[model samples]
Target: MTVVGIGYVGLSAALLLSQYNKVYALDISPEKIYKLNKKISPLKDT
Candidate 1:
């Protein structure tokens, strides 16, 4: 599954869906993609 835009909603959906499926997250921001690839959260959260 390909999830475009890794915003709050998109990221959440991707994370949830990923548990049972192969998820590929897409974003226009290279930094965000890079962070995700490195196992880092792209967004700030508590």
Candidate 2:
């Protein structure tokens, strides 16, 4: 499945669904893509 937008919400949802599905996260932001590729949070929620 494809999950557009790799934000916190998208990431969480993708992770949950990834257990039984292949998630292809799409985003226009390079930073977000970079962080996700490196397994890092793009935004600081704290």
Candidate 3:
């Protein structure tokens, strides 16, 4: 699946859906994209 806008919801969905199929996440922020590519969560956990 090709998912555009890898923000909170998109990233969550991509992570969930990826278990059963291929997932591609896209975002406008290059920094966020780079962070995600490195397996880093852009959002901070409480």
* TM-score of every model versus the real structure: 0.93, 0.80, 0.86
**Candidate scoring better on TM-score of 1 and 2:** 1
* CA lDDT, candidate 3, residue 44: 72
Displacement of the residue 7 alpha carbon in candidate 3, Å = 1.3
CA RMSD per model (angstroms):
1.2, 1.2, 1.1
* Pairs in clash, predicted candidate 1: none
Best by lDDT: 1
For model 2 the TM-score comes to: 0.80
Error of 3 at 11 (Å): 0.7
User: Model 3: how far is 45 from its true place, Å?
Assistant: 3.2
Supply the global lDDT for candidate 2: 0.88
- The runs of at least 3 residues in candidate 3 whose Cα sits more than 4 Å from the true structure, single-residue gaps closed, are none
lDDT of each: 0.96, 0.88, 0.89
**After TM-score superposition, what is the CA distance of residue 14 in candidate 3 from its true location, in Å?**
0.5
lDDT of 2 at 12: 87
lDDT by residue for model 1 (17-46), tens: 999999999999999999999999999978
Sorted by TM-score, highest first, which candidate order results?
1, 3, 2
Candidate 3, residues 1-46: lDDT per residue as tens digits? 9899887798899999999999988888999889988988987777
